[model samples]
Target: MATDVSNELDRADNVGRIVDSLDSRRVLLGALGLVGFVGLWWAGSTAQPEYILPSPLAVGLAAQSELASGTMQAALFNSVLHWLPGTVVGTTLGIATGVALGWSRFLDEALTPIVRVLRPVPPLALIGFAIAWFGIGHAGAAFIIAIGAFWINFYAAYGGVEGVSEDLLDVARSLGVQRQLGLIRTVVLPASLPEITTGIRTGIGRCWMLVVAAEIFGAPGIGRQIFRASNSLQVDRVIAYILVLSVMFLLVDTAFRVVQRRVLAWR
Candidate 1:
């Protein structure tokens, strides 16, 4: 037992070391990529008018100005307002429905057809209804965001739970856990959690992508700000806001990864 524990610790240490090395490489590569991208932008701007394509320096300056003006902060707040609620509602509902469908034959039979029909239609395609119902504000944007996230997590949870091994359930049954609900809690959920978490990660990224389109209607957000800047021919502000969106997504995704690693630590 002592030897086994030692071996396990050694293996964990090695995995940790490898992960650290990979993270370092990722950081270095990301920095190099950013530098190359900026260099290209600088070159492009030098060749063209600022209005057409702002240089990296011009964008940086505009970003600083936006920060000082606090308009960007307000936009960020508005974006998060819808994004947070939409993601939460969508993920919660998706998990519940997915777990139900995966566990219960009746639910699967009842909802599968409806889900199939709805799944292929992009959430943005429902923008007309969203605007008509919610009148193009934060609620409308959030509704659209929720629709996108719902399907992502829904499929992830459904497939993940359905994929849990029958052998695990058999063993649990032998141990006197008979009810599907109890079995779900004891075996299925934990076994399938990695996939569920992956769905969450995907949902988050999807919501970010949809937030832009969601705000196309008069909703106040970074996406709308990007649209406004573009209309005014303020290419620098548009680029700056686009960078802001990227940074926001990066931060949120990184946070989710941390939580996911902790949740999946049993693996």
Candidate 2:
């Protein structure tokens, strides 16, 4: 029995090693792919006139200059400030509303029709309304971002809550968990955490996309900076802002993944 247990343990160790090796290989390959893509971009841009496409080196230098002068910092701060509050408020409201709608059949039925009617309208389509309501400032940009984040969280939370097993519900009810709030807190919320996290992640990505568009319209952020750069024919600066935005999103995505792992540890 001792020998058998030792053999099983060795096999398990080998499997773990193999999995780690595969993960490392994936990371290595992804890095290589990104490097190759940048190389190709650099080469293509170098082959073209500066007016048409700025070389990666030029863009990198511009980005460095922007950072050194603190313009990049200010733009990044402005963008984050607009995005954070909007995301927080929209996500909170969406989750609460979604929980209510999913838990109550009558509420779902009543709201579903309205949501359906409004859901198809793109956030960009409401830019005019946002501007009219909030004026041309941070609030308008935030409103646009919020609109995008809200729908994402709403649908994700609703689906997650609706997906909870009826058997689980019955079990909870039998175990003296008959209170709706208690059931939601103990069972539904925990069960739906994974989906809710996914929705939040998606919303984060969407918020970034919308922020640029919102800024282009009238909001003061990275998007506005990029737009100004483009209008002034500063191709390198424009590319630099685009690269900065990409890096910011990557960092945000990594943070979200970390949070998801911690919050859903039970899973």
Candidate 3:
């Protein structure tokens, strides 16, 4: 028993060491890559005029000016307001529908073909229809964003549910947990959580993409700012907005990762 305990402790120590090593490696590699990218950008910018390709400092100054003017904040908030509601509603509905379809062959067969037909059509392709139907406002942008978020989440939830182990189902049955709802609650949900989390992450990314497109096409948001900057030949401001969007995406991705780690701690 003492030997077994010692071995277990040694194994745990090895795992901790491995995790630490990997974390350090990742940080080092990421920093190196970032430095290379910045060096390249600086070199390229220096090779051209500010109007052609602004220096990083120039772009930073432009961003600061926009922030000080409050236009950047207003545009960012508008985009977020449009995106948040649609993403929440669409993701929730998609997950619920996906779970139901995955759990029932009859439902899956009925809906799969329809979804397949709709899924291939890009959200941007439907913008004209959105404008006509919802009229180039928050509603239209939200609708477009929802469409993008829905498909990603639906497939993720479906795949996750379908991937649950048959042995888990059998074990639940053997334990006299005979109700379908009980099985879903006790076994299916827990088993499929990781995949669902992945889908939500993907959906969030899609929402960002859609927000830019929606704003570019007459919706009031950051994409509009980008569009205006481009049209007016304010390349530095355009690049600044792009940088801001990229930063937002990074922050959202990090937030999701933290939430996933906490929520799926058992895994």
Worst 10 residues of 2 by lDDT: 213-222
Candidate 2 Cα outliers beyond 4 Å, as residue runs? 1-16
Best by TM-score: 1
Q: Which stretches of candidate 1 lie above 4 Å from their native place? A: none
Per-model TM-score on C-alpha atoms: 0.95, 0.92, 0.93
Q: Tell me the tens digit of each residue's lDDT in model 1 across 133-245.
A: 97778888999999989989998999999999999999999999988789999998898899899999999999998989899878999999999999999999999999988
Q: Per-residue lDDT of 81-128 in model 2, one digit per residue for the tens?
A: 889988887888888888889888999998888999999999889988
Ranking by TM-score: 1, 3, 2
Per-candidate local distance difference test: 0.92, 0.89, 0.90
In lDDT terms, how accurate is model 1? Answer: 0.92
Clashing pairs in 3: none
Task: TM-score for candidate 1, please give it.
Answer: 0.95
Q: Cα deviation in Å at residue 31, candidate 1?
A: 1.9
What is residue 84's positional error in candidate 1, in angstroms?
Answer: 0.8
